[model samples]
Target: LEPLAEAGVDAVVLGCTHYPLLRPVIETVGARMFPSGLTLADGAEATAAELATLLTERELRGAGPGGLEMLVTDLPDRFAEVASRFLGEDVEGLAVKQVDL
Candidate 1:
């Protein structure tokens, strides 16, 4: 936060899927750290919108059930717990696997 403020950053983008969860904390810190007005962009929302547009343009929208597969480099249980928060549902029975790079 300090470095970004020092660098005169005007905006911060939440690029990762989990990053939106930290938006409030990040905004609070930015408010304290940044002298000028800072704009926070939600990349998750932008990505979702773009994906929907692309699907519609490509005529690839699906009408069937959707499946999600998660792969983690480490800590599958912790990832599942955190992912459940983002997904707004329990991921207990979801297929999550830990893989080596």
Candidate 2:
């Protein structure tokens, strides 16, 4: 509150997943200085919904024999360490592709 009051911020984001669970506290503080605060779950759900719509519109659903296509903003030096959670060990490398919206 003191920092935001000094800095004159009108909005802020609460990044931790648990922070949103304390929405009341966050909202109260934000209301005192900012217009809004959001949790990770809120953004995640909204993004997931959007991705679902994109998949439906593109007729891209379910895994193919080749499995799910992986795309990245940049290929990390440690691909397996990063990709394991979402893509798993099966995907050895990311075949780079570019898409323009």
Candidate 3:
């Protein structure tokens, strides 16, 4: 953070997908928000458009989303109950691993 201030990057992008969830804290620390405000499939479309331009410039474009593979690192006790509501399907017959951490 200090280096960015010294080096003068006027705008910073928190590129992590989940960083948007910390918008409140980021603002409290004096950062700006420029959100596309789209999720999931919509996010994929926006991503594709933005990436297509860059890939065309450098010719690095290739197909994406070979398939979906979800692996969660810490399955909370209530994960089953809450996941179905968010994922829109019952998460039965799926095994979640437990770790001490």
TM-score of each: 0.77, 0.39, 0.33
Candidate 3 lDDT: 0.54
Compute the lDDT of residue 42 as modeled in candidate 3: 30
Lowest summed lDDT over 10 consecutive residues: which window, candidate 3? 33-42
Once fitted onto the true fold, the runs of candidate 3 whose alpha carbons sit more than 4 angstroms away are 31-69, 72-101
Residues 1-101, candidate 3: write the lDDT tens digits.
Answer: 44655555445565655455554565555443223221222354478799889988998866666543335555644655566665678764466545563
Best of the two (2, 3) by TM-score = 2
Best by lDDT: 1
Ranking 1 against 2 by lDDT, winner: 1
**Clashing residue pairs for model 1:** none
Model 1 accuracy (lDDT, Cα): 0.88
Q: Is candidate 2 or candidate 3 better by lDDT?
A: 2
lDDT for each residue of candidate 2 in 1-101, tens digit (9 for 90 to 100): 66875676655565544454566776776565654532223565567799989998898966656444644444544444455654445445655443443
Off by over 4 Å in 2: 33-42, 61-101
Error of 1 at 23 (Å): 0.9
Which has the greatest TM-score?
A: 1
Query: What clash count goes with each model?
Result: 0, 0, 0
